[model samples]
Target: MAVDVEAPGLTPVHRELSRAYVEWLTPQDRQPFRPHVTLMNKATVEEAKAALAELGAGWSAFDSHSPALLLWRYLGGPWESVRRFPFTGRAG
Candidate 1:
């Protein structure tokens, strides 16, 4: 399932965070992390298609705040929150 969304003003902050993770994190994923907010997961393909269709031609943007970076461990239950590292809001 896939939906495309944009963070109009966060390109810089995302680059900084991505670099920090790549440098300081012990193990990293090989896939270059593209910053996107997930819209659907664990849903059937048809369901995803229907949901995206329901958005009509397009959708309006909204305001949101990112206060923290969450760390999760998947222990069979899917997500177990291990930590919430609040964003320092510091530029790289």
Candidate 2:
């Protein structure tokens, strides 16, 4: 699902983290950073639309905490967790 980096909560940490790693990111990834989490892959258009509709119907903003940063590598169909960097500071 898509996330507003400018929104309240864990976004400030995300924005700061992105800036900290800007040198490693490509131009497209650096500028205009639009944070989002991929929930599904390789789904058909109809299936995606249906899923979006179903999910969005109950979507709402809520407070959350980013206890750790997870690094993942896509291995064909499944993804592999590379590492986890735990957050040592507080965030809303």
lDDT of each: 0.69, 0.71
Error of 2 at 34 (Å): 0.8
lDDT of candidate 2 over 29-86, digit per residue (tens): 6666466667666788888888889988897777666777798877988899999988
Local error of candidate 2 at 19, Å? 7.6
Output the lDDT of residue 58, model 2: 93
User: What are the TM-scores, per candidate, against the unseen true structure?
Assistant: 0.61, 0.57
Q: Model 2's lDDT to the true fold?
A: 0.71
Model 1 worst lDDT run, 10 consecutive residues: 25-34
TM for candidate 2 is 0.57
After superposing candidate 2, which stretches have Cα over 4 Å from the reference?
A: 1-31, 90-92
Model 2 shows how many backbone clashes?
A: 1
Best by lDDT: 2
